[model samples]
Target: MPFALYLLGLAVFAMGTSEFMLSGLIPDIASDLRVSVPAAGALTSAFAAGMIVGAPLTAALSMRWPRRRALLAFLVSFLLLHVLGAVTTSFEVLLATRFAGAVANAGFLAVAVATAAAMAPPEAKGRATSILLGGVTLACVAGVPAGAVLGTMWGWRSAFWAVALLSVPAVVAVLRSVPATPAPTGGGGGARREARALRDPRLLMLLVLAALVNGATFCTFTYLAPLATSVGGIAPGWVPGLLVLFGLGSFAGVTAAGRLADTRPRPLLAAGGVALVAGWAVLGAAAGSPVAVAVLVLTQGALSFAVGSTLVSQVLYAATQAPTLAGSFATAAFNVGAAAGPWLGGITIGAGLGYRSPVWVSASLVAAALAVAATAHVTGRGPTSPDASRLQQTLP
Candidate 1:
């Protein structure tokens, strides 16, 4: 698991950074391409929408291949997509590239957790999963910021070129480093197998939790820049630095969740959920001032995503019988949040609620997520435990 996760982490890092780097590089892109800022914004949104559409489709079709082959294929597609994205000169082409790129990226993530979980020690699955997923948290903290710096000094095209270069190495590393695990797909009737997976209450609960968590986190994240500028009145120069604060906290949470999941996922999930509510509440009240708002957002990002990482791992563990389906569903839940959160936030803002509207709304959703987690605990019929997995193996 050690070297395998490390290799997976490398691919994760490359993909995570490339995906997020576009956000920071938009201004440069807009100017170079002679497009409006919002037009540039479409680049990021296209990627998100692609993930939403591609997750389940990729998982379903790729079921016949072993996990290694599937993962490798996804990464190769990802690398090709980035190359396509890098070569785009017009808006429509860029949008198409991002859409395809995102699908490839999402498919890669769906495979990563399943592959890592298979390699992990029985009780340390959380740690393995976290280490692989940590690339995203790290991207926020390190990759995007560095890419931003690269884009600013050299021009935005350099960012995509850099991503393309990184992908080549990642492909080689995965090919050489990741151990080949037999595909989790099997000999049964695929239709009956899917039906059984659908009936698992534990999986249903996990998807519910994932959607809730993403719904809440993304609600505010979508409007973070404007909210900070309008409500907190932070100057333009300080926005990037403030993002760094949030990224740092995310890194800390990612590291912590890895071990915390192994010790006790439910309690950790509950605690992180509570922290998300409190964190967003603090953000809501503090958005009136620059200093306080930055502090609160940093805290909020760290806690919310920490819980999210744990929640995803929890779902994978719960659906051990159908890891491929579960992994893809995890991505599906994330997009559900991504799509709903911003739509809801936009509605709240358009209602004349002002810049702080998303903060207030997201906070309430986080609070609801906490309530959902608590309800699950009380019911004792929620997300499946490892003990509930259909795959039987003697514990080490």
Candidate 2:
């Protein structure tokens, strides 16, 4: 892989850390701001909301600009927003900063995926995407925990400051390593072009697939801390360690999936879906068993991310006519799922279903995605080989 790909991953790491660290800081934020925990938790929802809007909006706005310049602009905004977050005194100000930061993060991610796809050999596009997204999984493994520790020792603001500092190096890396490529020619109005590109049924199916799969994963993931403590009878102190284990599994899954993505994405997708369903089932059944909970967290994380990168690759392949917009839509779809999962899980908990209820909810969503994948395969609309897709796109 190119060094630029790794730099993109580093950029993702900074963004992912900022995006996720808020979960750990909610309690502190609630206390410091004199608000309810749920209100502080809304900060997370605010960020996701920003992402849902920003991805497509940014993609459309930047459609005519060089990818490198768009990416750099987004990073500059991202860095500044984190600084704003660090300095904000009022909860409302902090929430606004989080939303702004997410907008920048969404733009950065959408462009990064498109740029990575453009940079890689067609045969290696999947691996290239994996390399770029690996930063996210790495954040889960390393950055979130470290931010939590930093926040606990100093203050929540410290974590934002750290992310701001991290973005400085990421900006430098992109300026040095990533080349500026001109936007594609023969463009109609950007909005019309993107709208027309989204008309493809295969692309739409892939977007739905992204949403369902991501929703399934987050349904369980958003409640893991409570489930670990209340259901598995684990100590609260052990929650962070369990999250690290989950991250390690995710890292391993994405790495392995990248190796097979170019040639065997369909099988990989099917297998990942099945594995996720099975993992959730086992987790629900063994919710009270600490050993089983630990094992299943790791298993679920691996299966979830294995499906994630493959889904992104499939969307990119299907959206050859509008790669950047497709990338934005995929990001938006994933955030939609991310936001929906926790809300649904919260409803289940409110209705008196135990914390383990999220496991079943996730399983059902993944099963739906599996059914869609099967339908696509049976109907001959599954992702094509990269070489074949390129040939088809080139034909008059």
Candidate 3:
């Protein structure tokens, strides 16, 4: 793999940190801004909303720009937005900055995936893509906690300042390391091409699968604190440790998936889906057992992330003409699932279903994803194309 791949991963780390660090800062932000916690929480929703709108829109607009230039622009935008977010005293200003930051984040990720795919050999595309995405998993394992600690020790603004400072190096790295590559051909009709790519059954199926898989994971994850305390009988103090276990599992899973994806992607995806379903089912039944719940949380995290790199690789494969746009769509789908999972889980809890109900809800979501994966396999379609090898050689 090229060193630039790791730099791209570094960029993603900064973005992922910005995306998740807000979770830890919300209480402080609410306290300082004199807003309700729920209102502070809406900032997260605003960021997701920006991502959902920005991904496809940015990808489409930047379709004609050089990959390296586009990436640098996005990184700079991300860095500045974090600075803006850090200095803002008004909650409304912070919210707007976060939304803009998310747009930059989405643009950066879409281009990064496309660039990685273009640079790797056909057989190693999955591994290459995973290398870039590993930063996000690493952020979950390390960055979020660190941000929370920073916020606790200093103030919420300190966390944002840290992210802004971290992003400076990422911007410099991208400008220095990433090589310029020409945009894909067919610029005049890029929008039409991307729109048509959305109509492909295989691409659509993959997007749906991506959404469901992410949704299933977040459904349980969003309520992990409550479940751990109320159902598993675990002490509040142990919850963070359990979350660390889950993050570590996710890091390991994505790493291993990158290696297996090239040789056995179908089986790998299928197994991940099955494992998620089984993990959730077991957790739902054994919710009262701390050991069982702990083990299942780790298992679910591994299975959930194991397939993430492959999902991006498949999107690139399926939408050969519109790879970046397809990738943006996948990002949007994941966000949609992320949003929906929590909403649905909240409904289940509101209806007097026990905290454990999220386990079943997540299981059903993954089960649906598994069914879609099966259908995709039966259709005998794959992401590979005759031009893939040639494109890899041409990438910077």
Candidate 4:
């Protein structure tokens, strides 16, 4: 991979670490900041709220700017946002800081995807995108864990300090390596292409499917630790180790997406949805057995994330126009699902159900996502089996 591409990937890695490490440090943060844990919880939700609103919104507003300037400015925004978060005094200030951080985070992803695709050889786009996204899996595998340790050692502030430090080099590298690209034109092929993409009903269906699966996954995943420790008989020491296993599975899936994303997406996406159903089923059944729970969680992470690379490609390729809009909008749809999943999971857990209750409910959610995904192919409205050589053929 080109050095520039890797830099973009590292930026993503830093963002991913900053985003995910919050979960591991929430208690420490609450204790140090003298806030209720529930209040700390709201901070995470607030950040997700920022991503939901910021992804497409930020991209749309920045459409007229040169891509390089847009990217660098956002990197600077990311640095300032986290630095503020690290130094905040009042709980409210920290919350606001994290919200800004999320906006920067989402904007970065939207731009990075476009940047990676633009940077790639037409045929190598899949690989370029995969490398970009791998930074995310890297965060999961190592960054979050490291941050967790940092938080345990020095405090939650140090974790933010770590993110601030890591991001400096990433911003510098992106500025050094990524080439200049023209501001997105308001007319020409891009406009026409965007219009065409919007005409696809399958894309809408895929969005719905994503929302459902994300809801299910987050519902279960967000509460997994408490469940495993309280009811699944897992030792407390095993939590991060088990999470590491899940991350390994997630990384493997992401790496595999580069090859599979190019060859075909509909089958892979659908298959992943089906695998999600199976994985959730395993979780619900194995909740009481530590070994079984670990195995199921690993399977869940592996199977569900296997299509990470393909999901974006499918959305982008679903229409021939406005790739930037399509890409960012797809990211928006994902945020919607993410937002809904946690809400629904919270409701389920709040209803006097044990941690295991959400597992089955989550399975049902994944099942719905799978059904919609399969329906997309059946109705000819979702991701199709892309023939890399058949671009000249008329799209249905």
Over 162-246, each residue of candidate 4 has an lDDT whose tens digit, in order, gives: 8989989988897788887788887345545565665667777766765676677677778878879988989888888777877
lDDT of 1: 0.78
- Candidate 2 residue-wise lDDT at 276: 87
Q: Highest lDDT: which candidate?
A: 2
Q: Could you give the C-alpha RMSD of every candidate to the true structure, in order shown?
A: 3.1, 3.0, 3.5, 3.0
lDDT of 2 by residue, 160-267 (tens): 999999999999999999997787554447656766878887888888888998998888888999999999999999999988988888888889888877777777
lDDT of each: 0.78, 0.87, 0.83, 0.76
TM value for model 3: 0.94
lDDT of 1 by residue, 1-396 (tens): 568788888888888898778767888888877899989888877877888888877877677777778888998888877777677788778788888988888888887777787777776777877897788777777888889888888878777878778878888887887777665546345524753776776677778778878887788877888988888888877777877887888878888888677666767777777777777777787787888887887777778778888888887777766766777888888878877888799899899998788877887877777676667768886544664243224423
The TM-score obtained by model 1 is 0.91
lDDT of 3 by residue, 1-396 (tens): 889999999999988888878767888999999999999999988888888888888888788898898898899999888888888889999999988999989988988888887778766777887887789888888888889889999999999999989988998898888887787676758766776888788888888888888888888988888998998899987876777777888888889988866666677887777887888999999989999988887878788888766777777777776766866887888888888888899899999998999889999999998877776667865433344445445656
Q: What are the clashing pairs of model 3?
A: none
Deviating ranges (above 4 Å) for candidate 2: 186-188, 386-396
Where is model 1 more than 4 Å wrong at Cα? 184-192, 387-396
Clashes of each: 0, 0, 0, 6
Supply candidate 1's per-residue lDDT for 46.
Answer: 84
In order of appearance, the predictions have TM-scores of 0.91, 0.96, 0.94, 0.93
